[model samples]
Target: MAETVQAATLRADVAIIGAGPAGLFAAFECGMLRLGTVLIDALDETGGQCAALYPEKPIYDIPAHPAIEAGALVAALEQQIAPFAVPRLLGRRIERLQGSRGAFSLGTDHGDSIHARAVIIAAGAGAFGPNRPPLPGLAAYEQTGSVQYYVRRKEAFHGKRLVIAGGGDSAIDWALELREIALHITLIHRRAKFRAAPERLAQLEAASGPGGPIELVVPYQLHALHGDGGTLASVEVATLEGDRRRIEADHLLAFFGLSTDLGPVSQWGLQSALHHIQVAPSTCETSLPGVFAIGDVATYPGKLKLILQGFSEGAMAAHAIHPIVHPHTALHFEYSTSKGAPGSRDAPGSLAGAGHAPRPAAA
Candidate 1:
């Protein structure tokens, strides 16, 4: 006889899927609207791709700030929503969604369930995995912990020999960033031309010049791996012309970008196109009532995939959801200055520490 497993259940006014920037901001919006929200994400942490893929990279287009690192933006967003204290269910993938608007149930693979009045799909590009290179025995090496798909910490590679594979922003960025800590860094790419930013490429060139700690092994691909006890000892490389060489290294970092899929969200029967959910531009509502999509996962004509745009969409979805969640109450739009967040009576007419005065209603 098999053991019977009991599922954990939770309830909230709104169940938000995905813990990316859009979803985080949605929690803040929902909180301001006095809606209880529970956020679910497949990743172990928030920030989605920004935190997972390029935490150290710089972002310029985010409004109000001249420049900010990708990770810093995520931190700021997290701090902004700290007052909400939104419940986060991480490291669990939503396996099934049942019921309809005003009453929905979400079940995760971990046997945890959530019952919510509304659902928001803010999953950016859905569930994503690393794109591994076609290196023989790569899986075996991965089992030994010598192969890494993502750089979780730079200091971990300190004083160690590393061979980074790929030509994209992640590969180039890590190669450049890790050069300072690693004993020696070798950037391996199949093509001489890189998909990294022009400025990054220039920096890499300058750093790799003369007696720099970095070496460029371009126009080459991984040919073989030599190791024992499941741990990688070194890697073999070959050029398109068939010339081969061996590069001794203790570890390999492959950042070939991500392989994304809609995952269980695709089985929800929502109208979708090319893996993205189709949503109304005005309300960010999906084909199903009481369900909304925002951020990179939501698509429509003239939709610009930007963080700022996703922030606006989250606010719109929150306002549209207000009527459904609180049927008896009419929503009155007020600036943060006019109606501060809850529990800020001491700082009336302001959002806590935000010193801006309330703007006149006519203005």
Candidate 2:
């Protein structure tokens, strides 16, 4: 399902795949370099997993701000790229990748062709889905929204009893996030030790008490879901000794992480291992010329799976790609502070100084 754009075949200096944090930043980087970029994603909207999964999740590592919600970060990125007016082909996946450096062709799932000088694959865990727990009558509950994998809306869980099961960040984060909205919150994990940020774990522990906002049920695994029709009544958990306990709840959030598949990306003739594309660390370019991989889907020696690192990689890839896009010209590197972004107050011939609005850059 591709959005109706100005033309059936879109052309650009760079065609970015994924539309996640890295992809969005790549668009901004390309725009700063005065290159036309188009963002394409399989999801209907931008922001990728951050928008789809946990929009309310807080990220502490992003530079500048001490803490920011995932959704807010996406919004800031969108606003940063507003002046460029980068074309977005949403609800579509790039299925085919062909051609070489400086001249590449891409075909999407919805019968759309995109021609670009360079391609950047910033896909984070390409084509991801949640890993659901195996429980009887789970489908019925899921159909009724009694059991959910992703928290798209926080208001839906307001005043409800929630039984969160998992030991990862998603489980703990949501437990802390929904503690205020939920009438009662119980987090059940098979292990007492949880894998999450220390500060977040401390926050969860601080709020947890015998009969406070949240309850911690450790060393207990989900045994079964007891419900009537599609309305969840309670969740049954058991220990290694087979001792079981039932926690009354209206909804169950199982966050076992994601089961990711590279899907069409692996079939794009790029070198890949364990569903991760192999790329050169310096340029982030894949084995296939003109195509680069970044973010979680890209793999290299000493690669850190961090959002900030992906941002750096996007900058590196853009600089590397400058030569390919403008073969005759040389790129004289300049800091963003020295060269203000187009349409900014500091930029030459800015709309602010001209007393008129700036038009959107062509994509």
Highest-scoring model, lDDT: 2
Q: For candidate 2, what is the TM-score?
A: 0.90
Q: Which stretches of candidate 2 lie over 4 Å from their true place?
A: 1-7, 344-363
Candidate 1 global CA lDDT score: 0.83
**Model 1 weakest 10-residue run by lDDT:** 354-363
lDDT of 1 by residue, 204-302 (tens): 999889899889998999888889977888989999899999999889998878899879899888999988999999999999899999999999999
Model 1 ranges with Cα > 4 A deviation: 1-7, 51-75, 342-363
Which residue pairs in model 2 clash with each other?
Answer: none
Local error of candidate 2 at residue 89 (angstroms) = 1.1
TM-scores for every candidate against the unseen true structure: 0.85, 0.90
Q: List the residue pairs that clash in candidate 1.
A: none
